[model samples]
Target: MSWSHLLGQRAALDYLRSAQKSGRAPHGYLFYGPAGVGKRTAAVALAQALLCHQPPEPGEACGACKSCRWIAARNGLLTNHPDLIPLLKNPETEKEKVLGDQEQIIPLDTVLDICARLSKSPMAGPKRVVVIPEAHRMCTGQAEAANAFLKTLEEPPPTSVVILTSSRPEALLETIVSRVQPVRFRRLSAEDIRAGLAQGNAKAQEDEIALAAALADGSLGRAKELLEGDLGRWRTAVMKALERAGPQACPGVGLALWALADAEGKRLFEEAEQKDDEPAADGEDEEGAEAEEEAAAKTESGWKRFVFRRLLDLCEVAFRDALVTAAGAGPDQLLQPDGAKLAQALAQRFGDEGCSRMLEALREAHFATRLYVRGDLVGRMLAGRMVSNLRRGP
Candidate 1:
C-alpha cells in the first residue's frame, strides 16, 4: 500500500524519505530485521514510490497510480511490472512453502538472471528496482552466486536500484555487506502487535488476540500463525503433560510431546503436498515440477525443526509462568494468563527452584538440538529431567 501501512518502522521509513528528498538514495540497501516485521513490505512500498507515474511527494507513493496499482497487483509479486525485479527464492524452491521455516537459498542461476535483466533498460519506468527477499539465503555455500551478486553490488547500474531484505545479516558476506546501505528494522511491541491484529482482523476475540500478541515475541507474523494454527490447544496439551509428568508418567509425557510433534509435522507435510498437487502456473514446466518436489522435501524437513523450536518456546513460557507464580506475582504477570491456575499449582508443587531447574533442562535440550542431537532423544531427556527435578524438592 503505502509507507503508512508499515508499523513499527517509523525510523527506517523516515530515513528512506529523507534520502529520497536529498537525492541521495543509495543504489543498494540492505534491510535487516526480525522476520515478519514488514521489511519486505517496506521494500515494495519503496519500489512503488520509485516507480510511481505520479508520486505524491518524495519517498511517498500515491498508491492509486497505475504503477502503484501494478505493484499492488498479485500482492507485490510485480510480475507484470517489467521495471521491478523481485529476486526472491522461487516459491517452488523455498525451504518451506510457508514463511518462518528453514532458510530458503537463492541459487546462482537466479543471481545470473537478475544480472542479465539489470543489464537491460527499464521497460516501464525511468528507473528499475530489484528486490532480493531473504538475501541471507543467497549464501547457501555457493561461492559462484555470492561472487556474481557481489559484482552487481560493487557497481550497480546507475539507473537501477537493488534492495536486499534479511533477518540474518550475519550470514551475509562481508564484501556484500560493505557495499550496501543498511536499514535496520526492529521487532514490534506487544501493544503494536495487538493493534495490528485488531486492524487486520477485527473479528478476532480480544483475549485470544492478547494471548497471541503476548506469545508472539514481537512478531506479528507469529501472532497470526498462533491464532490460525490453534496453538492454544497445543499449549494446553503441553501444560497438561507437564502437570502429569511424575517419574512414573515421564515416559507418557515424552510420548505426548512426540505425538504433538508428529501431528504438527504431519499437518505441515499435508499442506505442502496439497500445494504440490495444485496445477502449475501459466509458464511452469518440467523443471518447475522438479523444483516443487525438492521444495516440498525441504519444507517437510524444515517443519520438523520449527516444531521442535515451538515446543521449546512453549516450555519456556510454562516454566516462566510457574516462576512468576512462585514469586507471588499477579495473574496479569503470567505470559499464559489462561493457564494461571495451572501455573500457580505447579509453583506450589515444584517451587521456584524446581521450575528453574526444569527451565535449565529445557535450555540444555534446546542447545543440544541445535548441536544436531536427536530431537526425540532430547525430548525424552527433557521429560525425564523435568520429572526428576520436580520430584527433588527445593
Candidate 2:
C-alpha cells in the first residue's frame, strides 16, 4: 500500500512522504490525532514503503511484493510481517473494573518480549517497525510497562523505527512525548468526508450524507460511524421522547437512551469477538465460559463507553443547534440542516433559555459519564431536566 491509497490527510501524508524521500524518517514518531483521521493508515503505509522489496514509485510500496502483501494483511491492528512488532494493551483483563485504571497497562512482559525481538537483526525487511496503536492508554502514568519500554524508544535499533498513535496525546507522559518526533493529523474537512462517504458501498441518500457530514465534527471515522450506526435513530428517539414526554414518559427517555446504547455496545462486542475468533461448538467447558465471560465484561465496557459517549455527542450537537435556531439563525448557521424540521421543533419546544439550560445539563452529564457514573443515572438526569425545563407558555 502507498500513501496514495489513503484518502484525506494531505498535509500529514506529504510530511511522511518527504521523510521517506529524504531518508530521514525519524527513529521514533508520535502521529497523534482524533480517532479515524488516518494515523494508523499512515503508519501501515509508511511501513510498507520502508519494507517493500520493490518500489513501484519513489517513496511508495509495490503492492505485489511479499513485504507489501503481508503488511496489508492485518492480524488485528498489526501487520503479518515478521519484522512488525505491536505492543498492545490487554483487553481481556478488567483492570478498569478492579482498580479504576480506565484500561489495563501494557504488560511489561510483552514489552520486554517485543524489545527482545527488536534486538535481533531484521527478520525479513530493511527495518524492524514498532507500532503502538494506543499510546494514550499504554504510555500513561509512567507506569512500569511504559518505563520498561522506554529504552527501546530512547534508542531503537539502527534498523528499526517506532510509530505511536493516539487521540489523546496530552495524556501521554512528557518523557514519552519528548523522545519521538511529532506529526499532527488534523481532522478531515467536510468535503473530504463527503467524498469518502460517496465512495462507500452503503449508497445512502445525498441528504443523509449531508446531514452526517454536518454532524461529523470533521472526523471521517466519526462520519462513517454515524452513517452506519443507529445514532440517527437515537437522535429521533430523543426528539420524540422529549416532544411527547409527560410526567410518566419523561423518565422513559433516559431509559430508552440507556437501553439503546447498551444494545449497540453488545452488538459491537459480538461483532468484534466473531472477527477475532472462528466458529466453535455450541457448548464450552466451565473454565472456558468463565474466561470468555470475563473478557466480554472488560471489552464491552470500552465499547459501551464509546456508544454512550456518541449518544451524548449527538444530544449536545442537536441542543447546540437548537439554541442557535431559537436565536433566529438560519439553516446555514445551524447544524442538521437536512433535519431542519427536527431542529425547528426543538427550537419551538425548548425556546432560547431552555435550549441553553439543556446544553448545560448535557455538559454535566458528559462529565459524569467520564467519571464512570452509571449510564442509567446520567440518562435519567438528562431526561428529568429536559422535562422540567419544558415551557408551553405564551
TM-score of each: 0.85, 0.79
Best by TM-score: 1
- In order of listing, the candidates' clash counts read 0, 0
What does candidate 2's lDDT look like per residue over 266-365, in tens digits?
A: 8887886786598533212111121111222437765665577767777777778878888788888766665566667777877888888888988898
* Model 2 lowest lDDT segment of ten: 284-293
Q: How far is candidate 2 from the true structure (C-alpha RMSD, Å)?
A: 6.8
lDDT of each: 0.73, 0.69
lDDT tens digits, residue span 102-203, model 1:
336777867887777787788877678887877777786898999999998887888888888877799999999899999999889999888878886677
* Angstrom error at residue 239, model 2: 2.8
Error of 1 at 333 (Å): 1.6
Q: Which stretches of candidate 2 lie over 4 Å from their true place?
A: 56-58, 75-80, 86-103, 141-143, 200-208, 245-252, 259-309, 331-333, 391-393
